[model samples]
Target: MRHAYTVETVRAAERTLMSRLPPGTLMQRAAAGLAAACGSLMHGTYSRRVVVLAGSGDNGGDALYAAARLARRGAGVTAVLLTPDKAHPGGLAALRRAGGRTLPPEPEAADQAIAQAHLILDGIVGIGGRGGLRPQAAHLARTARESRATVVAVDLPSGIDPDTGETPGETVHADATVTFGSYKPGLLIDPAAEHVGALRLIDIGLGPYLPPPELEALQHADVAALLPTPVGETDKYRRGVVGVVAGSERYPGAAVLAVGGALRGGAGAVRYVGPGAEAVIARYPETLVTSGPPSKAGRVQAWVVGPGLGDDRAARQAVAEVLGSDVPVLVDADALRLADRDQIRRRTAATVLTPHAGEAAALLSADRADVESARLAHVKQLAEAYQATVLLKGSTTLIAQRGHPVRVNPTGTAWLSTAGSGDVLSGLTGSLLAAGLTARDAASVGAYLHGLAGRETPVPFGAHELADRIPQVWRSVHPRT
Candidate 1:
């Protein structure tokens, strides 16, 4: 798993570790790793001119010290000080000793240095940086970007909220980023993640001091462990049955797509109850299709409701019947709007709500832009409001429930934004719920598999085509013996 720590936690860990070490030992350790990563990127094939964009914090000091190492190895190194007065005294002196020169943030000289360099180290702003860059620094940063040199950020890209991944202003778009101590939430999420090209982490031995992660992204092994595998004695009913309440005559494909996802999601059988029964059976003959309320859909281990479900009176009744049932429920698409918050809040069984930004905005009574920019805050808010596990799907898929650290899905592809994808995801997740995983586990695993399938599918593929790729990815994650 990829764990991301909050800025406060990282700083606390650093402070505790720094207390036990010599004054400059931690900085030197960080510098050594940063320099080595820079050297690897260089590959000995350039004019060997390197420019360091240094701010006033230890982050800039790290860059300056690393540049000194490069200078000693014959790279032409120059530092552009954003705040000369507050620069680390030892770092400034060390660079000079190693035959490195300094330049002011004046446009002509700094931009010239940036233009001729093969690499630019972005230490202008690091962790805790917010808002846009200062005019002089922004000017130099623009020039560096305009240049062909590879830009590498220290810790994280400047002008981004390190803990939230929010880009409040113009940011440094780096070709790569080197982070120290541990990964930050900003590095794993978007807006900020978009600016980070390639990420590298260097351990300064702060592991033992850190607390539980603020966020985590599931890896292949983690997903493998969470997947449900059937034993030889298991029968169709013994494995699990997922009930899908989706689609309408106007949107019957939603039912077909939802049933497809459930069938592929390790369920023993699929029980589909909605207006799309004819369309579903035509496409999926194995499904036990019904044309009534969800209560009479037979003994289903879980229920998935709301995809393409129209706002007709019957559709509302179907949503009410399913929510009133005593079983795990996945509420998606149109159901999200129809399901009462009080019903969701009072349910003893697990409830999972999957909503995109627009859906979430409706639930929260907020602007879509606000939800998009503040995903973490909004996801948590929605989760608490409904008292259910919430999966906010987008560029980054986040699973949130009250008192649990959010799970940031790393496998999502922008291509997965196509139509009817949410319906498929709802069915797949509901099947997992019937398989007996907790609300959080089921949602996390379902999203994990869904994202992997999206990434593996050919671009421009239809929603059904993406669902078709689920078993392929499932096998890849936990391959057959």
Candidate 2:
């Protein structure tokens, strides 16, 4: 798992680590790491032009010290000090000693240096920065961006909320970012993630002091450990059975797509109940199909309801029966509209609710924009409101369940915005739940796999194609003998 720490936790760890070391030791370690990264970005350090956007505080100190190192290595380094008087005195003295020149914060000189530079280091604002950049810094940042210089941000890009990844105003766009101590939430999530072209985390010995991660993105190894493996004693029924209640005559493809996802979700068998039984049988003859309600769909380990299920009388009744059953349930799409809030809240078995921003907004009676803007907050709220695991799908897919750490999916591309994708996701998650994973684990793993499939699938591909790629990714994560 790739863990992200909040600013507070990072600061605390830095302080604890710094307390035990000599006064300037930690900063020197950080500067050395920064300078090394800068060197690698260049063809050679000798006679190369490097510009450092040195602003207030230790972030500027880091930039200035790293610039001094570059100057000593024969790079023509210039420091554009945003706060000349308040700049770190040690850093300034070292730069001057190493023959580095300083330029006052003037747009003309700044732009010229930025335009001619081989590299630009952004230290105008650090992780503590909030809102947008000041005029002088923003202008220099804009110039650097317009130039061909390879821009590297110190810590994080200027003008992003380090904690929440919210870009309220103008932010620096960097070719790469070198963060110190630990990863900040902003560098890992969008719309700020878009600003961070490439990310490199430089450990300054702050790991032991840091607390538990505020956010975590699972990697392949973590997903591998969580995936279910069949034992010698396992039979088809023992492996698990997933019951899918989806589709209508108007949109029979939803049933086909959902069943496709379930088949690859490690389920021993899939029992499908819906109006699209004929279409499902035609496509997946292996599926046990019935034109009956979910309750009468034989024994199933878990139930997936609501994909392409219109808000008609039969759809409403199907949702009610699924909720009333003692088995785990995953509700999605049109079922989100017809399902009773109280019925969902009162369910005893595990429940996973997957909603896009619009559906989440409807559930909370808030604007879609609001839900999209504050996804982390809204996803948790929905999980609590319905007393179910909630998966809010978007640029950053989040899975939240009450009393559990909200998981952000790092996989996936914008291409996943195609239609019927959510249906596949719902079925995949339900199958995992049937495989005996908790609601939270099922939702998160399903999202991770689904997003990986989206990334593997060709662009402009349909939802069915996305489903077809799931098994490839699953095998890649953990291959069966």
Candidate 3:
């Protein structure tokens, strides 16, 4: 699992580590790591030209010191100081002592150096800075960006709000970022994440002081452990059954897609009940389809509702029945928008609400922009408010349950944005729930599989292609025994 700490957590850890060590100890460790990363970028081209964009903070100190190291190793290094007078005094002295030259604040000089450089180190700001680059720094950064040089950010791309993962103003676009200690939230989430090209972590020994992370991503091995596997003594009924309530006359394809997803999922049996039974039967004759409501349908370990059920009275009735049942419920699509919070909270069975940005905004009575800006906090809040697990879908999908750390899904691609994708996800997740995975586990595993399936399909895929590739994803993640 890849854990991401909030800015406050990282600050606290830095303080604790700083208190125990001597002054300048952490900075030196950071600079050393930075220098080593820069050397690797040189790639046997020690005679390459390097430009260091220095600011007034510890971030600039790291770049200046790193440039000194490069200069000593025969690279022609030049530091373009945005705030020359306020620059780290020790770093400036060290760079000069190591034969690195410094240039005053001149746009022409900065432009010339950047154009001729092989690499540019952005030290204009750190995690502490906010609201993008200052005007002067922004100009220099733009010039560097236009150059052919590979830009390396010192800690984070300057001008990005590290905690919120939003780019507030002008920021440098990095070819790669060398972060200290651990991964920051900005580097993992989108908008700001897009600016951070490739990422590399340089350990500075701050792990002991860190607390539990606010969010985590399940790796391949982590997914391997959570997947459901049948034992020798287990029969179909012993494994688990998933009940699906989806589709209507207006959109019978929703039922077909939902059943398609469940059939390929790791469920023992799928009991599908809805008005689209004929359509579902036509596509998947093996499905045990019923025309009655979910409550009247035979017993099932879990229920998935609202894939294609429109705002019709029958769809609402099906949703109400699923809420009243004693089995876990996975809510998605139109059902998500029509759900009653009070009824959802009153349910005894485990409930999972999966909503995209617009749906989540409707649930919270807030705008989509607000939800996107504070995604982590909103997902957690929804989980607590409705007393159900909340999976907020986006580029960086987040799954949070009451009293548990939020898990972010990192495996999705832009190609997964096609129609009926959510229905497939609902079926897969509901199947996992029926197979006895916890609400959180079911959501994360489902997302991982859905993303892997989307990746397996060629880009620009239709929903059917995404559904067809689920079996391949399952095999890749969990080999049959």
**lDDT of residue 31 for candidate 2:** 95
Tens digit of per-residue lDDT, candidate 3, span 119-226: 999998888998888889999889988999999999899888787688878999999999998888888776678788888888898999888887778988899899
RMSD in order of candidates = 1.4, 1.6, 1.9
Q: Candidate 2 residues 288-364, lDDT tens each?
A: 99998787789999999999888789998999999899999999998899889999989999999999999999999
The lDDT for every candidate, in the order shown, is 0.90, 0.89, 0.87
Point out the higher-scoring one by TM-score: 1 or 2: 1
Ranking by TM-score: 1, 2, 3
**Residue ranges of candidate 2 with Cα displaced over 4 Å:** none
> In model 3, what lDDT does residue 70 have?
84
Task: Identify the runs in model 3 with alpha carbons over 4 angstroms from their true place.
Answer: 479-481
Count of backbone clashes, every candidate in sequence: 0, 0, 1
* TM-score of candidate 1 against the unseen true structure: 0.97
Winner of 2 and 3 under TM-score: 2
